[model samples]
Target chain A: MAEHTLVITPHKTPRSTNITKYFSLLLLTVLLIVVLFPLVVITLNSFKTEEEYFRNGPLSMPSTLSLDNVRAVWDRLDYTTKLKNSFMISLATALAGVTLSLLNAFALGIGRIKGRAFFLVFFVMAITLPHEMLAYPLYYMFKEVGLYDSRWSIVVIFAVLHSAFGTYLLASVFTAFPVELLEAAVIDGCNKLQLLVRIVIPINWPSLSVLFVFFFIWTWNEFFLPLIFLISNANQTVPLAVAMFQGQRGAAATFQSTAALLGTLPCLIFFIIFQRTLAKGIIAGSIK
Target chain B: MSYKRTRGYIGFLIPGVLAFLIIVIVPFAANIGISFTKWRGVGTPEWIGIDNYERAFDDTTFWASFQNNLQLVVAMTVIPTVLGLLLAVFLYDNITHHFGPRVASFFRAGFYIPQIMPMVVAAIVWRWIYQPDWGILNWMLNSVGLDQFSHNWLGQQDTALRAIMGMMIWFQLGYPLVIFMSALQRVDPQLYEAASIDGATWMQKVTRITVPLIRPEIYVVILTTAIHAMKTFAPVYSMTKGGPGKATVVASYFSYKNFFERPNVGYGATIATLLTGVIILLSVVFISVQTRQERLESQ
Candidate 1:
């Protein structure tokens, strides 16, 4: 490697160049603040009493860190129940979706399938279609089949609807694996199932973790389908609960703020735990 | 290589293909079929043969929403792609040390927080900040002597769509930035070394080397962003509800209103079909251009 050069040398820099870099950084900082400030405001406000909230500006820090707002929203929204429902639905979707997707990806990507390209393209096309277009049809279909209003129905819909895209992502990971290793395993009298469990699963833990975190976050954040399909507040996901809070109009701010604070917690926790894997998954998912 | 091996491959594809057919393909085809009918989703359907499409074409709300979507597509495609490419280049160039990429990646993840956050949460938070009377945004503006610029951002037609688009750009910048960074890393370091050896400057190295190698990704970004812009619903639904006299409406939101809110399933299906057709056309054009470029390079 060449020696690293740091120049404090008096070089003539163009005024425009200096202005552009400074401008870009300034703009970036402003954008970051804009994005993060509201979230911070919500969290801060959630700790303030209702009186404190009304008296002070939304941006102002709470005078005392009290959890009155949090307590009130939690009681009103039944936040723990909502959170449990959300977690159950999300976990079910992620687990089932990831497993099915891994199987599909393995078969299509590494099993020397004849029509792999056709299936891959079909999934891509499926992904491109507007999701809302399918909602009415799916609603009718599920109602006709008596699957409506069931948690399993929502879980199945979320999982299967997202399965193809997840498979498409996982297929890229499968494609990068060494084919010779699989062939050698097969030669050693390993069945297809055994080979997958022993060889592919062991080697692809990183990809699997990435997919898990991605699907978890996605299912946790999903709103539209859950809002339409899950009518009862008893079965409402966190996002749905939050959205329903908005339906009350003027009184919605405090409730909505509380909901926002509650809804973002799980995702923030997940991000903190699996930040690197989450980044990898996002980059991988986007490219394909 | 044998017939048995072929059977194995067929067996492997069966479950996935069947699931996809039932969940995705059937619903898609059903949506298309519904577009040609006069059903309110409860009654038996009557064949209306392009009436819904005609109504969609004539509906001023639909057109306005389509226009908003077009604006979004244009803004998102250009602004995010350009800004993301610039950020990718900056990170790649400035952060050449061991810890540079890691720090940049951390920032990239930070930027993605909006993307990962539920749209409901994002919209609620933004709505709070954009609240005209009691908003933090107005407070900050007044403090900075720019109070005149403050408005009910999501409640005003003039600034609602733009404000929402700004939110989208902030939320979406991370995905493309990360993709571009990966594509940038794939660029052979030797080329940059050779460019420097030939007395080419940093700008020249980027324009000639980095940009060309990442054209495919750029195309993908444009295609995805455009399609996503057209189909945006969650933010609109959560933030403005197509409000300030439907100024923030998009095609997908219109479809949603027809389907769920109004129960005009046929009309919603019509809008959806049109949206899908547009998306398919864009994708075809993009794929064809990419293929043509590849063929030219081969020759």
Candidate 2:
């Protein structure tokens, strides 16, 4: 069968293809520069002294690279406290959100569930409503319940807000699982919980991991909710800290660059570490 | 496969369903309810019927902001979608090459930095770059003997929204590009080869083969970008605060200020409800038209 049929076509000349390829490469290079130049300027200027920042152009290198600006930004923002709070909020949200979504997906995907379509529509509606539309009501409700300023308020809100999309993605993955495997497990008298824990989780680890990383990054970078909910300076996230820093440095030219750098560093490190998973997650979400 | 398990499903779904109801559904319904009443957070909301919506229609500031948002949607959606498709084609055609695809993917990720980074941080960096007197852009322009073109970009009413729209295009082009690249790779190579053997040029191949194959992805990208453009608040809030006489105030930012900052909860909800209605209507129209087209093609 492998050798049953054969077809051949003449290959195009390497010279023509090479010229077009080089032209595409040149265009791509120009785009890369335009996209990355702002970030490059920020990172470079973040290291320069105050006088050097003002005297030299933004794209120029400093005569002497120094850590003074970084240190100053660290102190000004009380970096340690903000970092700890952000970490706690982000980790809690990701863990709780992913777990709940997985459970929801399993129930809808594998279980002999009634009203699955209804639940799916509910989740879709949740995703469609803008976050701003829910802000005021949530604010008032949290205030009434006395959870407004607590870290748990933001964490729970973030987790709940994220669960809708997470469930949608995870459920789609679960639907692709083989039905025979689940039936075989059930024939052996394995319960739903045991089946989900023992079989489904292991089979879908890649998808789950992708969702986890995406949710972590999104929750960590979420700004508006934390800004509205977390009233105290002590509980502010990195984005809030950066916004406040920009507000304070509105008058000062030098501190703004350093502040932006300080704020972007953590997320940049996370992105570098999880670049592949992030790419997979982004593709998965967008393709559907 | 038997429908024997009744209690198990209920137990599994109860927690997630309850959470969604309390957090998402309740608030969403309450938002609609609140739009019909006047409230200032300090007193009881009095029923005002359609007064807020009526005022929103006549409000010059609201119209200006809505128009700005429509402009943003137009600018960001069309340009980036086209650019992304081109980039995706370039990458997909070079997929077998070792270094080229990697370099292209790296550029894709590089373009995504502005999107993933908090808008506040990106705005701060860009504000400095757009500074007229000591900024890099003006400096470069002057050096290239285009000094007449240099102006305070964010300070001018006429240019502020366009400047921000340009920033939005920069930030948003990556996601669509990545998605299109993946979709392009999934396109059957036989189609392109067949087209080429039929004496089709590159432009003809793209129009006759690539665009038709990627219509679904294009629809998704356009819908997502339009919705995103409608909900844009952080950039304007951080960078301009809808300044220069409300020049850059998109509807979302206007609603946000009215709701939280200015304590016009009724008015804010009215604007938000209207925006939501428009979005839903547009989505319905798009989906129905696509569904009809798909049905016709299938038949």
Name the candidate that leads on lDDT.
2
Q: Give the alpha carbon lDDT tens digit for every residue of A120-194 in model 2.
A: 877866666677788888888999999998889888887887888888888778888887887788788888788
Instruction: Please identify model 1 stretches exceeding 4 Å from their true place.
Output: A1-31, A175-183, A247-255, B1-4, B95-99, B143-146, B188-206, B297-299
Q: Is the docking of candidate 2 incorrect, acceptable, medium or high quality?
A: medium
Q: What is the lDDT of candidate 1?
A: 0.78
Q: Write the per-residue lDDT of candidate 2 for residues B1-299, one digit (tens) a residue.
A: 64244347567777788888788888888988999999997689999998998999899998988888898897678888988887777667653352556776777777777767876677777777787777778988987899999999998998898888877788778878888887887798788789888999877888888988888888888888888778787778777889799899888888888888899999988888888887777777877988898888789
**C-alpha RMSD over true interface residues, each candidate:** 2.9, 2.4
Q: What DockQ does candidate 2 have relative to the true complex? A: 0.51
True contacts kept of each: 0.54, 0.55
Error of 2 at A138 (Å): 0.6
Clashing pairs in 2: none
Which residue pairs does candidate 1 place in steric collision?
none
lDDT of 2: 0.80
For every model in order, what is the number of clashing pairs? Answer: 0, 0
Show where candidate 2 strays beyond 4 Å.
Answer: A1-16, A247-251, B1-7, B94-100
